[model samples]
Target: MAGQAAQIEGIVVKSTGSWYTVFDPATGQRSRCRIRGVFRLRGSRTTNPVTVGDRVKAEIGADEGDNVITEILPRTNYIIRRASNLSKESHIIAANIDTAYLVATLDRPPTSTEFIDRFLVTAEAYHIPSVILLNKMDLFAGPEFREIIDELAGTYRNAGYEVLEISAKTGMGIDELRARMQNKTSLFTGNSGVGKSTLINAIEPGLDLKTGAISDYHHKGKHTTTFSEIFPLTGGGMLIDTPGIKGFGLVDIAPDELARYFPDLFRLAPHCQYYNCTHTHEPNCAVTAAVAAGEIAGSRYVSYLKMLEDDDKDGKYRK
Candidate 1:
């Protein structure tokens, strides 16, 4: 009942816990409606249950000019994060996205490579194409942060990804990013201070989302986006901007298969003798050998090991 993507009627554009803003296809109108009572108490959904991109059937009240969510449609693919609760359920981030943008900053409020790796691994596991967006190019002060950005871009690109360096302040690479968004759904995500809002304004300026400045004293961004919102791009496709995430715990991967998601690591995994090698202590392990030979970025490898450790401790529940 909860996971099916019903193609019978409308699209869910907004989710506010108790209600969903749905765009009806027949009448070409949008309305806010609560989920059926049975659907709410079903408790099958982990986080708010229905995400913003869900397509569902809405039955309008006879001559009442309103509707209620009757049935949810099945999803082709859904992006999920570990739920923030003791129960440890899976929280769906969004459904049916074309690509996921992990917007990052090189200097101020530096996004740890560990954070980036976790998000990337999760995307890989879910078969989602992901791109790393290096934002705030105008603020690159010196060789250190600049070199770091270059290294990050090279690391991901070598691992077979598209990386775009942009400056929300100077309007540098927004065109390249927008060209990719043409006629496809995209999810813009990053740490709190990486200027996600600023970049969105520069790209489509009409949305005018509340942009927050990072606190100079602490180098942290204030929470400007309270909830995940879906906005239509100029011609086609959609952009779902989610609240800044402090940590991303992958929900459903095993320790043995952890190396498979890291594209760099998986490339070398075939040489290992044991098909199920964990790489921590496996003899003749190709993954470890690549690590020693500098074939893979050390930071990404470290993140992989940490995810294995977490999987051992918490099983499939996202922390």
Candidate 2:
């Protein structure tokens, strides 16, 4: 009885399938733990039963090596996407996030608008406030690139998202970004080459997270962050860094309700003739009218249509 383990409450800071690193706020100690058997049979459909940013209760063994997570506390919110193009299961990216920062790039392994929209849709569905961080501003010096950047910023801004044009390499918008991240749990995610890790390193220099180069042949970013992990910020918040994702498939969202997640489309849906306008072909659809009127960005509309059609085999919308 003297050696019996005691239960402790902590946050799951890192997850690598079989093992989790739980960080206790009270003791500032992290314990490597495995989940109890019942967790696997809890009827949850996600690929991982326990994900980073999850608050959990675990038993700290006397030897410390046999710690077992016993319970997952209720989450305030979480971002989820289909686990794979061919799989039905979902993958919870992170839970209890205060803000979701989607780092995007115009070129050097360009992050597609569809991918951006999809990620925003998921964030909207979960009621998580999202900020679009347009990284690599230093490279967009040419007139053509500048025009593209302006249009991209305007498109999302009009759709009601805060778009920050930042150069993680040059510290252009790092201060503002850091200010926004203060005292909040933020999730930094994006396509492989969008500089999520580099940006984080710029914000918290001490982290020095590993970064990768763009594939010259494909112009895509090589995966750098292998797993999801949460880090305490020197300023006043926590950050969850995840592996670069290639495709973000919508999970648990009905086709009919997809438009609600798109802020611009949702605002115009009320003016449509039909109560349940798919915004595809409904007569007098305000969404289509807005598109034709240039009130909504064509690129965003195209992304919506693609998601509605659900035809992309790998869930990666290509130009």
Candidate 3:
């Protein structure tokens, strides 16, 4: 009977509330598993007790094949946001991600720069490398839209992030995009209608994940992917696709520590006149000066100020 209690280690590929799909690399097998009732995530106060991309250990049931997760291994890093419509709690997006790809669109469902920066700040705080994927290039062919796309790409690229211009419709820049994701575990995320699933289907054809259309009246995307799931790429890496999020609220970040998440702002902050400059109304603030000098992107500073407002009003980062 003791021998029957063998343990198997696996990576969580999908999470659906009470059930998780774990993939065992050694035997190339998959199993549906549930965690022990007493188990809790060590560090995060997440809505889900377990998240996709988590490494875990489980014991297979003898009579029924359903497994019981006995342990949730420590995560190297994870990306999270305030729980949807729940201000007091947070939701874990994905764990142990090597990189996060934030897909943005210029039209059909415009992605605000504020949204982009908030995501970037969260990625910075979690120590996850982030790449800006400017998708739907085909829609940005007009001269005016082209300028906007170019400037947006240049802004992030100058801020020390890799920005790729891709079109899931036309297959533009797909090879380059695929090359970067070859050996890394990447998490693909963005607002709904930004074509996260479409991009993945282009990168790896057979998945054929569902796609959705934007609301004509609100010009917003409808949620298509309901849960986060991880898939192994044929090219030697893994990818985590997350449900589209309407807003990315910062969690556990204070007003003072917020600037540290913005690379450009953090670099210039030490030069501020006041040691504790919030950069809001402080005299001789270097960050504000940079903004005036056009050294810092104005849109970025606006996003920062918006976050500060949220912090002041409720102490939680939310749109």
Q: Highest TM-score, which number? A: 2
Whole-model lDDT per candidate: 0.79, 0.88, 0.85
Tens digit of per-residue lDDT, candidate 1, span 1-319: 4334333378888787777888875777877777776765674656566788888887655422345788788877777877331347767788888899999987677888888888898899998899988888888846767777778888888778888888989989888777779888888888898888788888777999888889999788897887777888898878887888777878777776777788888887789998877777778999788889887778877888777777786554232
**Which sections of candidate 1 miss by over 4 Å?**
1-8, 41-45, 62-66, 83-87, 313-319
Lowest summed lDDT window (length 10), candidate 1:
1-10
- The candidate, 2 or 3, that scores higher on lDDT is 2
lDDT of 3 at 242: 85
TM-score each candidate: 0.89, 0.94, 0.93
Q: Per the 3 Å backbone cut-off, how many clashing residue pairs does candidate 1 have?
A: 6
Error of 3 at 74 (Å): 1.9
Steric clash pairs (candidate 3): none
For model 2, the stretches where C-alpha displacement exceeds 4 angstroms are: 1-3, 311-319
Q: How many steric overlaps does candidate 3 have?
A: 0
> Model 1 clash pairs?
4-73, 4-74, 5-73, 5-74, 6-73, 6-74
> Which 10 successive residues of model 2 have the least lDDT summed?
310-319
Write the residue-wise lDDT of candidate 2 on 1-319 in tens digits.
Answer: 6569988999999999889999999998999999877877773687787889999999998766679998899999999998444578888899999999999998897898988999999999999999999999899867878788889999999999999999999999999888888899999999988999888888888997899999999999889789999888885899888999988988877777888999998999989999977787668999999999998999999989888778444533333
Candidate 2: count of backbone clashes, pairs at least 3 residues apart or interchain: 0
